[model samples]
Every structure is written in C-alpha cells, then in structure tokens.
Target: MARLRDLAKLIRTKNAGPFLLTLDIMFPDRRTYDRVVASGVIKKESMARFFSVDESKVRLFNYEPANAIKVTVPRLVTSGDPADTDLFGGQQFGPLVNVEVPDLPAA
Candidate 1:
C-alpha cells in the first residue's frame, strides 16, 4: 500500500471562500491520476469523513485535463471566526495526506 502523500504530486487545502474549504489532489502524471481515481478511496463520503462534514455538503470535481481532483466542503468554522484556527484553511489537509491507496506498479 502507498499513502496518498506518496502517490500524489501535490495535496493541499485552501479556502474556497469564507464558508468553504477546497482540497486539491494533484497527480504527477496520467498513470498516477488514473490509479488514484480508479481506487475509489477518494470520494465525497471519504472526504466528508475526513473534514467532518455532511456527505451532501462535499463537492468533488475531477479535472482530467490537469490531472487533479478538487474537493470542497463547508468549513467547520467560518474563516476568521474566533474558533477558527486555520484562517486560510491551509492546515486542514492533514487527514487526506495519510489516506491509504493501493500501490502503483514500478515505473
């Protein structure tokens, strides 16, 4: 097995807006992208669990051309709210980095 952090070229999170956070899973090549997408480990339900949001509130966009998957969820705390620890939502991607994925064949 391989961790998502190993398979993906870049995994990051940021504020889509004051009320939403976006996670970007970018793969280095088409082979890696295809493997990750087919793995089915990265989906709305999984993302919802990772961010602790309702499944219906997670929006996933697979941008094939860019070899990237984008997931957006409602922020647990509004940006700049007193309870918000990550003002830019940058620190919210921890859960996704360790997500397990089937190993890729050697290049």
Candidate 2:
C-alpha cells in the first residue's frame, strides 16, 4: 500500500470559515498526484466518512497545476465555539496524514 503519508509531501488543514475547515493534500510531483488519483482511495465520500461529516457538506477539488487536492468540510464544531478544541483547525489534518491508499498491482 502506498499510504497518503508517503505519496503526499504535505497534508494540512486550516479554517475556511467559522463553521468550515479546509484541507490541502499536496503531492511531491504530478506523477505522485496521478497515482493517488488513480488509486481511488481518496474520494469525497470516503473523506466524508473519515471526517464524520455529511457527504453533502464536503467539497473536494483537485488542482492539477498545483498537484494538490483541496477539501472543505464543516468543522466538527463551529470555530471558536465554547466546545471547540481548535480555533484554526490547525491540527485537523492529522487524521489524513497516515491514511493508506493501495497502489495498483504490478501487471
């Protein structure tokens, strides 16, 4: 398996709004990005499940030029809410760091 942690040079998250967060998965190069995309492991539905967010609230965007995927989802709790743990969602990308994506089997 080629885990996302291996293919991605960086995976990070930040506050998109008081109620939303943005995640960026950056690949080292276009080859790696293509491989990850072909692997079919990082779909929007999967991310919705992984992040415990409703699929309707998740948006996945691929930036081919940047070789990155940008995802936006509602924050687990509104940013700066009384119960919110992270104001900036700075640590939210941690869950994606170790996610595994199986590589295509050699023919």
Candidate 3:
C-alpha cells in the first residue's frame, strides 16, 4: 500500500491561528495530487477522526494550481495554552503521514 508520505512531496502542519491548525499536503505534480484526491483518503471526516476534532470544524481545500490539499481543524487548546505541546502545530501532521492511499482506478 502506498502511504501518503510516499505520494506527497511534502506534508506539513502549522498554526493557522491561535484556535486552528492547518495541514498542507503538496504533491510533486497534478497527477499525484489528483490520485490522492480521487483515492478519497484525505477527506474532512477522516481528518476529523484523525485529529479528534468535530466534523463540522474540519475544513478541506483543494488547490489544483498548487497541487496541494489543505485541511484546517480547530485546536484542542489555544496555541500558547499550557496544555498545547505543539506551539506551532508543526508536529501535528504525524497522523496523516502513514495513511494508506489505494492506487488510482485504471482508466
């Protein structure tokens, strides 16, 4: 099974704001990006489950020009909150790294 880490050129997470964290998955090209999108492995519901956030709070954006998929979810605690270990949310993308992405359907 090809994992997300293997398919994406870059997978990163960062603080969107004090209350939100954003995950960016960028592919090397549109073909790769489309494969990931079509595979349906990176949707809002799955992301909500991965981050333990409410489904309504998860937002996904597909930018074909950039060959990227962006997902934003509410943080459990404020950015600087004592309970928040990831001040910059840079380490929050671990859950998605190994997500198994099935091969694209044969045309």
Cα lDDT tens digits for candidate 2, 71-100: 999888999889999898999878777788
- Over 9-81, each residue of candidate 1 has an lDDT whose tens digit, in order, gives 8999999999999999999999889899988999999888888999999999999999999999999999999
Clashes, model 1 = 0
Q: Let me know the TM-score candidate 2 reaches against the reference structure.
A: 0.92
Best by lDDT: 3
Candidate 3: residue 35 lDDT (0-100): 92
Please tell me which predicted candidate would have the highest TM-score against the true structure. 3
Q: What lDDT score belongs to each candidate, Candidate 1 first?
A: 0.92, 0.87, 0.93
Cα-based RMSD of the predictions, in order? Answer: 2.0, 1.3, 0.8
lDDT score, candidate 3: 0.93
Q: Which stretches of candidate 3 lie over 4 Å from their true place?
A: none
lDDT of 3 by residue, 1-107 (tens): 69999999999999998999999999999999999999889999899999999999999999999999999999999999989899999999987899999988789
Assess candidate 3 and give its TM-score to the true structure: 0.96
Q: Tell me the TM-score of each prediction against the true structure.
A: 0.94, 0.92, 0.96
* Alpha-carbon runs more than 4 Å astray in model 1: 104-107
